[model samples]
Target: MEFRHLGRSGLLVSEISYGNWITHGSQVEEDAALACVRAALDVGITTFDTADVYAGTKAEAVLGRALKGERRAGLEIFTKVYWPTGPGRNDRGLSRKHILESIDGSLSRLGTDYVDLYQAHRFDHSTPLEETMVAFADVVRAGKAHYIGVSEWTADQLREGHALATELRIPFVSSQPQYSMLWRVIEDEVVPTSEELGISQIVWSPIAQGVLTGKYLPGQPPPDGSRATDENGGRFMQRLMSDEVLSRVQQLKPLAEQAGLTMAQLAVAWVLQNTNVASAIVGATRPEQVLDNAKASGVKLDADLLKAIDEILEPVAERDPARTYETSPKERP
Candidate 1:
């Protein structure tokens, strides 16, 4: 697997990282999850991303069990905070109290002393930015986190956070956002800003939540056991199942066929086309899925193929324009 710097931080991560999101604790059994993790490791995927809120906080525990003993030391683990873990108000957000408490819980669940990257799952509007930054700085100083990052933050928020981290001498190494052929919102501002600030962009849902995998057809029923079947699957994903998007995805199949690659591989390679992207965090339910995704790491997309893909998914605008910017210290660049 090719390695890239996690922003300007000196830490190198695999271009295609493994992530436990909707599949680990909820969709797949423990043994299946363990098999997937092992398969990822065998293929040189060293970076693993998870969130405290995924699968009701059980995802980290499953990962910890899977990576117990010496296996834990061989990988760079990343997890996020800010989503509500319980009914109590104190169970969420980037407040000093919440961040301190959440990190301890994450460490205990992951069976690790420090996370390679600790990200804010989303901007917390209720808390002060300075308070959150100071708390993150304290965690870095205490060695509970190796680097800090944020997910789905806007350009202005990233700039402010970078400024604060610069003034405080804390390193903000990466930013996580939803980016793919089906969703190109970050290209307008987030991508350019991160490139300028020397922050690596780790993208999630690079396949548009499996819409680009060619499994979902324009007029057919949702595939069995897909994320679209989940109760929380929102309108954005519903739109992804539309005839227009499926037609666009179909247009790319010929390209993948010509390249001797799977549709999923083409989708992933398309995401890694940008040099600013450090890694694309992909989730898998089976060992073969992990292996399939690993193929994308080595599949280089030629200029002609890229132009074809852009033409197929043209009129390229932000998928979710309703998501506006919110300021917070947990936000990163």
Candidate 2:
């Protein structure tokens, strides 16, 4: 696998990182999850991303077991905070109490003393930004995490957070955004802001949650056992399952053939075409999927094919920078 520096930091991560979002503890059986993780490592993937909120925090434990014997120094493990991981008032958000308690729980579940990157899963509207940043600073100072990052945060949020992180002398180095050929929301603003702030984007859903793989047919029922058929894990994918989006995605199959790649590889490589993307995070339930996605590393697509893809997906792609995220009112702490 090809490697790149995560943002401007000295730390390097595999360009195609393995992420267990929906499949680790909820979507698939433990044996399948372990096999997939083994496949990723066999293919030279050294970066793994998970979240405490994923599968009600069971994903981290599953991942911890999968990586139990691996050398810690050779892997870049990333996890996130925020989102309700428990039922109590202090169970979520980026509040100082939540951050402190959450990190310890995450480390315990992940079976690691420290994570390479600890991220805010979302901008905490309820907590003061200073409180969150200071908590993150404490996390770093305590050696629980090497760097800080935020996921799906707006450009404005990133700028303010980075300023505070700088003031606190924290190594804030990455942004985990939902970027793909079909989701261009980050391109208009977040990419530029991240570039300026030395924050590289480790994009999730590079295949538009598998829509770009051409597996879902237009106006047809979703295949059995696919993400769209999952109750707990497919909520975010519902938006892109429309006939219009599926039809547009189907048009890219020929382009994948033209590029000498499978539809999934083509989709993954398409996201890496952007210079600001440090890595594309992919989740898999099968070992074959892991093997297919890892090949996306170092596969360069010509400008002409990229233009053709844009033309095909233009009508259906979500490009508005305003679509970054839903600003839910701060949950009562």
**Top-scoring candidate (TM-score):** 2
lDDT of 2: 0.93
Candidate 2 lDDT over 131-170, as tens digits, reads 9999999999999999999998999999999999999999
- Give candidate 2 regions above 4 Å deviation: 327-333
Per-residue lDDT for 1-333 in model 1, tens only? 989999888899999999998887888899999999999988999999998998999999999888787465668999999988877868888899989999999999999999989998887778888888889999899999989999988888788888888888888989998888988777878888999998989999888888889988877888877778876543448767778778778878888999889998988998898888999999888899889989899678899888888878885335443243522344321
lDDT, each prediction:
0.85, 0.93
Could you tell me how far off, in angstroms, the CA of residue 78 lies in candidate 1 after the best superposition? Answer: 0.3
Which pairs clash in model 2?
A: none
lDDT of model 2 at residue 20? 98
**Candidate 2 vs. true structure, TM-score:** 0.98
Backbone clashes (count) for model 2: 0
The C-alpha TM-scores of every prediction are 0.94, 0.98
Q: Worst 10-residue stretch by lDDT in candidate 2?
A: 324-333
